[model samples]
Target chain A: MTEERDPHLARLFAEAPEPQADEAFVDAVRMGMARGRRMDLAGALAMSAAVGLTCVALAGPVAQAVGQVAGQVAPVMAELFDVPGGEILAVAFAGLMAVSAMVLSRVRV
Target chain B: MRPADSLRLSNAPEAQVIALAAAGSDEAFAELVRRRQGSLRALMRRLCGDAALADDLAQQAFLQAWRTLRQLRSPGAFGGWLRQVAVHVWLRHARLVRPPLDPIEDLDAEPAAESPDPAARLDLSAALAQLKPTQRLCIILNYVEGLSHAEVAASTGWPLGAVKSHIARGTARLRRLLSVEVLS
Candidate 1:
């Protein structure tokens, strides 16, 4: 069936002009792809903030429990870790987890 | 020239490039674009009827191919697979943006060159413009691009019967156009 068609048409169309693309267009696509790869810092920061706030919210009861524990060993903790204080330590741990979660969220895979 | 030697489907450099691109290798993806850009652009232009639109579609197609390369089972089928991506990308883009009506009938019909020399093949591009998008693609994939019917079916995602029908119809239209040009 195909043989019945003009063999020359295939040849002619086959001879089509080489498809040329503008260099800048190619560059733009490359740039778009590059931008797609980079992390959106603002988005990441916002997510981090949300995670941190959530952690802090969830840490309320945990913090009360820690406070109860600390009341019993306040003097001991003071001697062992006399820095930012236990409440601060607890908050810091929660903050760290939130930050980790936020960073993890930014990853594509 | 001769459709750039009818590139074989291979897991070679082409497939590796697609794989690497899928793995987020920008350079590898760029290499794939650079290698296939000519043919892809040509096909897009033939199918879409505009060089600028073709370029845009080609870029999108390459990006899409890069994003989904991992889904492809055989790396050896990258070229055909990529063409399929291009076709979908073109169609999608066309859908999103209305196609400007082309008075295809108004275009002057030109005769196919008698010469088989490399320069003669240059006329193929003009002849392609006379065809409908589907017919042009069929001819390009089958003759200029040298993909088998099975490959064409696979690449276009059309049933084997549909592929055969399109090829037959497309070839007839092209032949008629060629004859018209010759007589004119």
Candidate 2:
């Protein structure tokens, strides 16, 4: 169904006074943006610091765990599949996972 | 663009201003804000029914735009993008503080007594305050801001049919409230 147009309402809306943003409002917004930018910078720096510290803190434990797991699995894999360099492969896989975790943590989404 | 170039961008086209603003030029962003604030503020006031809140929301919207300016795919659509931000800000605020029942129903029960000179006392803001939120949004965006129905739908993320229905019903209600006579 076609809707009827109202000339009176349209005229009133057209003639309605537009609200102005005074100097104070503009300055306030500008200042707010500045503060927001500062906060954003501070937040990103804090996050980066936190992530770096976390990786540093976890490095020893992660290395130990990866060593133990690799030690346990390498012989089994070598015996089962006759694979060479199983221990090196496990260490490389663990390093890849740790690097992936660090990268993923920094990603915003 | 350098700091000195901002003064030049003030008079430049919106696309240029948006591009510079996205490139981290505060002055360019300020220019865009100065250019669009009036209409955005007006739209917010009509939508929110409070000047102070409208200004607050508009400012927040501008800040948000500044942060995400690079995400703006089309520089030419800056005005619409800014408006959509303002509307979303208002909607978020509205959602947080909205009452259980529709506020318009409460307003409807307490209609002001007709003025001795009805036409003289009629106000666009007052009439708008009487409308349901979605209806008022559609009405202001369509009639006041001069957006097409599809544009309104795209901006509000509402369906095109819903936008049309709201405009139709909202206009009819407004005419009745203002005692506008139908001219066949």
DockQ each candidate and list the results. Answer: 0.28, 0.40
Writing each residue's lDDT as its tens digit, candidate 2 over A19-93 gives 765767778788998899899899999999999998897776666665655676566556644466666766666
Error of 2 at B73 (Å): 1.7
lDDT of 1 by residue, B54-112 (tens): 78788888777766878888878787788889877865665466454222321233235
Badly placed stretches (over 4 Å) of model 1 are: A1-6, A20-25, A39-109, B1-22, B97-132, B180-184
Cα-based lDDT at residue B32, candidate 1: 70
Instruction: Give the CAPRI class of candidate 1.
Output: acceptable
Q: Model 2, range B75-158, lDDT digits (tens) per residue? A: 977777888888778777776777532323433443444454556444678878887787888888888877888888888787
RMSD of 2: 6.8
True contacts kept of each: 0.51, 0.63
Q: What residue runs in model 2 are displaced by over 4 Å at the alpha carbon?
A: A62-109, B1-6, B99-121, B181-184
In candidate 1, what are the lDDT values of residues A11-70, reduced to their tens digit?
565455776645665676687676655545667888999999987776665555545544
lDDT of 2 at B93: 78
